[model samples]
Target: MSERREHAEPFPDGSHGDLRADCERCFALCCVAPAFAASADFAIDKPAGQACPNLRQDFRCGIHRDLRKRGFSGCTVFDCFGAGQKVSQVTFGGQDWRRAPRTAKQMFEVFAVMRQLHELLWYLSEALTLQPARPLHGELRLALDEIERLTLDSPGALLGLNLAAHRQGVSDLLLRVSELVRAEVRGSKKDRKKDRRGADLIGADLRGADLRGANLRGAYLIGADLRGADLRLADLIGADFRNADLRGADLTGSIFLIQSQLDAAKGDAGTRLPPSLTHPAHWSPGDRKVGPVVGA
Candidate 1:
């Protein structure tokens, strides 16, 4: 498990405080519940329900400070949206899988469901904060309340949920929120028509592009050169930013830009971000000179 900052202030229904990962209150559920294949992100193959060799008995990562060097970088970018602690402390009442061996399988299954629900809460909380999305606040709040209620469901009830259908319903509402927020940007009709939603831009050069109010939802931006790009007010929900160069990019006020997406990208001090997100620790402190833009 990775260390995360604690958010003390509460949001609607007092659910915002626990939207960020808090590994201390968790039971190392992330480390044991998910299966990992040997790849650039992970150094070894790990099976579901089995503890990682690097997981300490205290539920902390053994290579917490050196996960990148240890080839476990994937672990660093993972954000459970505080679902681990919620399941461990609230749903299960602090009952750990180890102490109750019979509950291990069910606990892991519920963790999966709880993680998705918590992620929806994170996005909804952010949506409620956007002034441009004020028109949808009532809808967003109602959705948030419903999801928060679902989070407290018993493990059996959670596992019985049709997560895909539920997620689609929330995603539809979020899409409306994104449109409401992004529409505040005064972009030309031509620019507005340049919808990059789910576009395949892998390794494409996008340096210094004017992408304000662009729709990049679910776009494959892996290794793209986005340095100095203006991404303000862009809809970045589910965007794949793995290794994307975001140095000098202005993403201020970008909608649905989550910390995990930024964690997977390469950025620097010059990369402007929304107030809700912080610079990833892995980002460089200084900018580096690069060649001219390839495909603007």
Candidate 2:
């Protein structure tokens, strides 16, 4: 998952500090590198490699305060995991696409590769922090270090990377970590059925369900009613939570839960989250009735 630009309190040791996006250090790579279709998420159809019309000369979104209202909700949830800044300042040596039009195409290509590599770094960094996954920490660290080095490769080298194969290797390791961590939660043999990996739960009414230790990786949970659900120790990697109702849900110990997922869902102040995550500003301070789930 990409990094969000929201202001969050840094980890005490600041180990994952660079994993978060620093828009000020970036040259608006996200606005120019990716193609955007006119959809519920984006207000306009934008071709790849072209800067969004809303992008300002200072590299800030012109509708920053009213992106959603202006039909650019998609822009608000995108997080490059610091890839924009890394590509702008490190890969290209602080040269922006506008300043070096000849290199703009190559820069956009490298940004794609760099973003995925940085995402792996984010997941690996989080895996190391899970005490239950201590046995795999050494492997995770080595992988993280390797990917971190790859992010520093020259643009040509970055573009040549076998990203799919590399991502699969790292994904296999993360699955192992997920299993190790989820094993800590004692559950009845019947509860083993909670292995809903890649389950199609779209628009399902799952209010107050006991999802503890559930393997929900890649589950399509769009528009699901997850209010007051116990998601502690759940493996939520890649779970589609768009429009999911999380009001009063307990996710404090949920594994692999990221901010982008929360940003897309509806939550209230009563939603309990991991210490590493912050509540989305759009979440209501108190409980509000959620509308009926709309089909994807």
Candidate 3:
């Protein structure tokens, strides 16, 4: 099989672009934290908290040479926001979690927290690109400050975060940002159409949100709880869902989004499977496998 080449368009000239390559610094946390089922992309089943078969002892992909051929397409989409390396080199100071079994659980928890915090940074960085959100720039800057402070917290403090409250705060601000950006992107003349460009929706609890056919082009959705989200026909071009929960999210007709984005978003059995995702048999998460994307 021919190797697929997917070049990432970094957010360009900022912390976002700089953070794009940070995954290598950590423990490959995304691969171990998520679960998966057998599909065209994977040859077996794997579950959360278990190391993927494709993962090597050196913290590299064993099948990097043929990830697609080996049925692990989902692996292609994860972006750790440099948390993997931060947790590995900086947080744990190059100590292997496997060797320090006493701290393994802590390591996992820290990994999870750092991942969320990093995801928030991704959105804040993107929000800078949205020229229309100029009015809210002050507010966005404040929010970014709050999130950045959280990133510097100790592992113990990070694990103890009041994530619910934090999410609520971020969600409210993101909604305002979204509305403002949407107004400019859609313009006053366009009918009451959906417009969600550059919204800082990180960690927004959008469970069962009605976004069907809504225009979410270039929206920053990192770490948003999209459980049971209605993404049907939603124009999701350039939307960033890194670390966002997409369990039960219907993305049937959403255009311009790619499997790489989905790979970063968290999904579970309750998560509605997109046809484009191939379930890998190496996935120990569950027995069920995801079918193919019909349109593609």
Highest lDDT against the true fold, candidate: 1
| lDDT (tens digit, per residue) of candidate 2 on 33-129 | 9999999988889999999998899888777888878877777778787888899899999998888899999999999999899889988988887
- Give me the overall lDDT of model 2: 0.84
Over 15-40, each residue of candidate 1 has an lDDT whose tens digit, in order, gives 48787888889999999999999998
Positional deviation of 150 in candidate 3, in angstroms?
1.0
Better TM-score candidate (1, 3): 1
Q: If scored against the real structure, what TM-score would every candidate get? A: 0.92, 0.93, 0.63
- Model 3 — which ten-residue stretch has the worst lDDT? 1-10
* lDDT of model 3 at position 166: 73
**Alpha carbon lDDT at 194, candidate 1:** 52
Task: Give the lowest summed-lDDT range of ten residues in model 2.
Answer: 287-296
- Model 3: per-residue Cα lDDT over 1-296, one tens digit each: 11223333434353455445454566666667666778754677888778887778877777777775666655665556667777777778888777787777787778878776766666666565456567878887888789878877777888899876876676576556555554533444342445566777888998998776567767889889988887765556568877788776776544445545766567755454444343222222664445334345
Stretches > 4 Å off in candidate 2: 1-12, 286-296
The best candidate in terms of TM-score:
2
lDDT of 3 at 32: 76
Per-structure clash totals for the candidates: 0, 1, 36
